[model samples]
Target: MIWEKLKEWMGGGEDGNGEFQPEWITLLEKNLPLYKRLPDEMRQHLHERIARFVESVRFEGCNGLDVTDDMILTVAAQACLLVIHRDGVPYPGLRTVYLYPSTFSSIHKSVDAMGVVTEGRVHRLGESWETGTIILSWDSVEQGARDIRDGSNVTFHEFAHQLDHEDGPTDGAPGLASRAAYRSWARVFSESYADFQELTERGRKTVMDAYGATSPAEFFAVATETFFEKPRQLSGKQPELYEELVGYYGLDPREWLP
Candidate 1:
C-alpha cells in the first residue's frame, strides 16, 4: 500500500499534473497561508512533494497525542516547501517525525570552560536529530501554518536543520553545486552570521530571528525561515545572502508575492 502511494505521489495522479485530493486542497488553503500565494505550478509541485513525504516517512504521536492524517499533511506541506524546487528524493536522511500536543521539556546539557557539565530540563517546540528523527509540537506547527509572513516557523526551522545535515554534520552550509558555490556560501554566511550575532547582541530588531545568533547551523535555519516567509524584506536588506539561498533552493520566493 505504501509503495503504491509512493508511486502515485511520484508519478502524478490521474490528471497527470500532480493532483491532490479536493479535501486536502481545502485544508491547505485554510491552514497554510502561503499555499494560496504560490503560483499554480508551484502549488502542484508542492502537492506532489507533500504526498511523497506523507507516504514515505513515519509519523508517531507522542505524549498521548494521536497523529491524524490532517496533521501529517499540514506539517508535511510546510516541510516540502523547502525542497519543492530541488531535485532528488525529499529528505533522504529523514525517516521519522514525532508530534506532541504542545510544548515539552527535555534534558539539556552544557559544558563550561572548566569542563564541568550541567544538565537541566528546557522547554522546546521542536527538535531535529541527525539520527533520522524529528520531534515537534503540533500546536506550534499549527501556529506556524496560520502565519506565513512572520519569518518564524518551527517546521521550516527544524527541516532546515535536516537539510543542513544531509552532507554531514549540521553546518551553516548545505550541499552546494561545486567548490566555488561552497566557497561563496561559506564567505557570505560567515560574514552575515557574524553581523547577525552583533546585531542580536545589541538587541536591535532584525529581519531574522535573534535565536539564529546561537550558531552557524542555527543561523542557516533562521535565515531559511526568513527567506521563505519574508522574501521581499530579506532580499531588500540582505541581497547577497538572499542570492545564495536563491541559487541553492533554485526558486525565487519573491515571485510568490503580489
Candidate 2:
C-alpha cells in the first residue's frame, strides 16, 4: 500500500494505478529529446518500462543531493530504453542505483604483465559493479539525456556493463539466445574490437569513441551508446556491428529517428 501511495503521489493521480503522468511526459520531452523521437507504440512501452524500473530499483542520493521525482523519472526512462523491446524483467542483477551530484572519485586496481598490481584513485562519471550496485553522476546523466546524439551516455554505458555482467562476468558478451547467436556475437565483436583498437591507435576517425579501445567490456558499452544515440552514423560506418546490435536489442533505432 505504501508503494501504491508513492505511485499515486508521483503520478499526481489519486487512483494509484501507476499510470504515466502528463507532467512526466513533459519532463521527458524537455529533458530527453530522444524520448520524443520514439515511435508512439515504443513510447508507450517505455512508459511501462520506466514505471517498472522505478518501482524495482532502489535509488539513493549520495552526498547532500536530494533525489527528486524529476531526477528519478529522467534516469529511469533513459535506463529503460536499453530493454524497452526485450521481454521479462530489466536488469535482473541490478538492485541499487546510487546517484551523485557530479563526477565522483573511485579507486581502481590494475595488473601488469609482471603480475604487479597497482591501485589508483580516478574520477568517474558512472560505475557498474558486479555486486548489483551502480553509481552515477547526475550532472553527467542529465547532460547525456539532453544531448541524445553524441553517443556518450553515462546511464547507457553503466547499464550496458550491467547487461554484460548478467551472463557471468563483465566480458564483452552478454547472454545470447542460442549457440549460433553466441558464435556470431563473439566473431563480430572480437574482429570489430581489434579493428576499432587499431583505428584508434592510428588516430583515424571512428563512429565508435576512442575510449572503446580500452577493453572488450568497455567496447561493448561504448557500442551500445553509439547504437542508440548515433544509429545512422554507426550503421553507415559499421554495418555488421549495427546489424548485430539491432538483432540483439530487437529494435531498429533508425526507425525511431527521422
Candidate 3:
C-alpha cells in the first residue's frame, strides 16, 4: 500500500503535471528503432507526446535490471504510437507503468458466492487495465524487441490492451473514429476471430499464436502484434481483418517493413 502511494507520487498522481526534459528527447532519438521508421510529421508529433508520457510515468528497476533511458523511451514510443495514428484522443486513464527484471508473481483476490476471499497466483510478463496501470518485465520487453517474430511481444500486448481500454473494457474493440468504421470493425473482427477460434479448436495449423483464440480481446491484441511484426503474412492470410486494422490504425506497417 505504501509502495503504491510512493509510486503514485513519483508518477505525478492523478493529474500528471511532470516536466518534459530535453535530455529525454535526445535519449529517445539515440535508442528507439521505431522512431527512425516514423515520417517527419509523425516523428515530430510522437516526440512531443512521448516526452510528456515518459515524464508522467514512473519506472523502477527491479531484480537487478537496469532501467535505462533507452528502455523507457522504447516502451513509451511503442505505446504512444497507437495514439499518434489517431488524433485528438488522449491516453485515457493510464498513469504509471511498473517495470520488473523478469516475469513477476502477484496474488489476486477473488470472492466467491459466500464472500470468502481466495488468493490466486498470477505470473505474467506484462499486464494493463482500464484503471490506468501497466506492468512489464524488462527481460521480456528486450526479447520482444530483439525479435519481433514468434508472435509474442509483452510491450505491444500490454499497450494494445491499454488502447482497448481507452473507451471502456477491452472487448476487442478499441473505439473507432466513426460509427461506420465501428460497424465495419465489428463485422470483420468478429468473422476473423470466430474463424481463428474454430481452427485452433480443431488443432489446425495457424499462422498467428494460438493464445489469440482465448478471447476476442486476445485476438485483437495478438493481431496488433502481428500487424506490426509480420505485416505481410497477416495481410496475405487475413486480408479483410488486415484492411480493417490498416484503416483503424491509419498507418500501413507493411510499407515500413522489407
lDDT of 1 by residue, 1-258 (tens): 333554665676756664466777888888898999999988988877886787678999999998876788789899999899765568998999999999989999999999999999999999999999999999999999899889999999999999999899798889887999999999999999999899999988999999999999999999999999999999988899999999988898899864
| RMSD (Å) of each candidate, 1 decimal | 2.1, 2.7, 6.6
Tens-place lDDT per residue, model 2, 124-220, is: 9999999999999999999999998888998999999998999898888998999999999999999999999999999999988999999999999
1-258 per-residue lDDT for model 3 (tens digits) = 223333444466336653334565565555545566667788767755565566566677767776766677778777777677544423646787888988998878888899999999989888886788898998788778656556577788898888898777789999788999989999999999999999999999877889999989999999998888888999998999999988877788887676
Superposed model 1: Cα runs more than 4 Å off: 1-18
TM-score of each: 0.93, 0.93, 0.80
lDDT of 2: 0.88
Which pairs of residues have clashing backbones in candidate 1? none
Q: Per-prediction count of colliding residue pairs?
A: 0, 0, 1
Q: Which has the higher TM-score value, candidate number 2 or candidate number 3?
A: 2
Which residue pairs in model 3 clash with each other? 94-132
TM-score comparison, 1 vs 3, better candidate? 1
